[model samples]
Target: MSEKSVSTVVIDAPLAEVQAALFEIGSYPEWLSSIKKADVIERDGENRVLKAKLAIDAGMMKDRVTLDYDWSAAPAALSFTMDEADLLTQMDGTYLLKAIDADTTQVTYELTVAVSLPVPSMMITKAQKQTIDAALKELAERVA
Candidate 1:
């Protein structure tokens, strides 16, 4: 495990709406600035993504990554772990949603990732914050 970056944001949408947007894995590139492409490799019986390949360009770091995804219906959460990647040694993250009102939801994102290159912890944390902040803002806009 590497040092983790955790952050939260409030989305101007209901919990269900926010979760729906998050589950639309194939549309990630449209809203997530870092994601260049997202392709589903496999799906479960419920047609939910089981595996996906993503190409990401995050300024200082870039990689084509494959990840295994798990969705927890009870908690309205989505989590993923890296199955393989060109530059990333480990990638694990989760998105947890909590409703603040009928039309507002709080989203918490936590990520821990390690790249193959030697980079300082401060740099990694800085990148993580930028990624998280951009992702949450886009997510909010997508569901708005």
Candidate 2:
């Protein structure tokens, strides 16, 4: 696994609204350009996504991946781990949300990804940062 990359952004939305946006995994493709498709495979009792399958196409990386979500820390944090993928060996990520004010929220994204092929550590780190930053930017736009 590569070192985790973290990025933060402030969104012009309430905490609940930001949380709702992140919880709606099926809508990811609409806002996340790298995510070509997102399908919820399973949902918990609370109607939160427990598992999902996502088709991603991000330049050099393209793969269909299934991920298992951990919503135990929800309302503030959402985390996921890769379950199956063609190219990814490990994909663990978390989104942490904090209410900065009634109409503003701070979001922090942390990601660690590893591919099946041999890649340089520096390249992996760079890719991770790029992915995290892009995701955060997209999320902010999505909730705006």
Candidate 3:
């Protein structure tokens, strides 16, 4: 599988705050454009199960998929793996928050999303990058 990746925006909030804000996936539609609905399905230990539906490309494409998440609070890392994703053969994303200074942080978002959907548009990477960008922006705005 080929690797796809992106880096997130650095939020002004502390790592714990940022992590906590991200856990509120249900509020994504308040700030995120592509997210239509995000519902937490279950929680097991430090992992979470989610069912997410996203609208993409002006409602031309939509996907509802299950995801499993693993959070490492000590290192401030949130990792997601696809359970069954449409328009994706395999998908994985991670958010890494590292303390840069007292009131600043370094946030990195990375994803590897594979598309076997009909025609493999050369723009898949661009689209995924835009998604991550919007996510980072929302995170910054919410947690900042």
The prediction achieving the highest TM-score against the true structure is 2
- Clash number by candidate, in order: 0, 0, 2
Q: What is the C-alpha lDDT of each candidate?
A: 0.88, 0.91, 0.68
Q: In lDDT terms, which candidate is top?
A: 2
Put down candidate 1 lDDT per residue, 45-134, tens digits, no spaces: 888898999998987769999999987653478999999999889889899899999999999999888888889878888888888888
Off by over 4 Å in 2: none
Sliding window of 10 residues with minimal summed lDDT for model 2: 56-65
TM-score to true structure, per model? 0.95, 0.96, 0.79
Question: Runs in model 3 with CA error above 4 Å?
Answer: 45-61, 72-75
RMSD for all candidates, in order, please: 1.2, 0.9, 3.0
Residue 21 of candidate 1: its Cα lDDT?
A: 86
The C-alpha local distance difference test score for the whole of candidate 3 amounts to 0.68
lDDT of 3 at 117: 69
